[model samples]
Target: MDRGTVGSAQSGRLLVEVREEGSSAVVTPAGELDHHTADVLREPLEDCLEKGYARLVVDCSRLEFCDSTGLNVLLGARLKAEAAGGGVHLAGMQPVVARVFEITGAEAVFTVHETLDAALAD
Candidate 1:
């Protein structure tokens, strides 16, 4: 795998970078992810699944914030990936973003990794 960015999308609040690692599509979204910027992250994730990268690793170390809509976008991706025999893996989640998942019990539904490297390794 080249590890180069296969695609990317950026909005005012979010910048999403997509790359390939083995069979997993690593999507890194930096900055705030809210209702207004959810699509910036969603499109790249959906595109990864469409392109047959069923495993998704979200490197959220750079992500500073995430709202409910942002969580929904991830949940949606998880469902899509699961349907295709894959699942979403969340890695390096910041405290704020992780809090949302915790509050919503979304963490229970996905495989959460402490780091991006760990996520890809699994």
Candidate 2:
């Protein structure tokens, strides 16, 4: 894989990293998040909910791509969390991914932050 290219930093595929900070949960998703890797986000998100985390932050700083499938996963997670009286924040979206949200009119539905710290603070 070529260095500095998209999705090359961690095996040219999606990598979801989850951690807990106080009562909040952080899930940092890196790499492509099209149909093939949408499920990569599901488990960690579900785990956070199962662990009773009411505050969730999804750090998208390293995410290289996202398709409709990826968007669906995010939407589902958002609904599930909000239904449970919790909410999810999207952090550090790349331009391409952010455009997808904009095109789909999902930007208004999510609480998007420019950084993980900002998301966590909210």
Output the number of the TM-score-best candidate. 1
Candidate 2 to truth, TM:
0.88
lDDT of 1 by residue, 1-122 (tens): 55867899999989999988888889999999999999999999999999999899999999999989999999999999999999999999988888989999999999999999898888
Residue pairs that clash (backbone atoms under 3 angstroms), model 1: none
Q: What local lDDT score does residue 63 receive in model 2, on the 0 to 100 scale?
A: 88
- Show model 2 residue runs off by greater than 4 Å: 1-12
The lDDT of each candidate is 0.93, 0.81
Q: What is the TM-score of candidate 1?
A: 0.97
User: Against the hidden true structure, what lDDT does model 1 obtain?
Assistant: 0.93
Candidate 2 per-residue lDDT over residues 11-112, each given as its tens digit: 348888777766677788888988878777887788778878766778899888999998999888898889889888999999998999999999899999
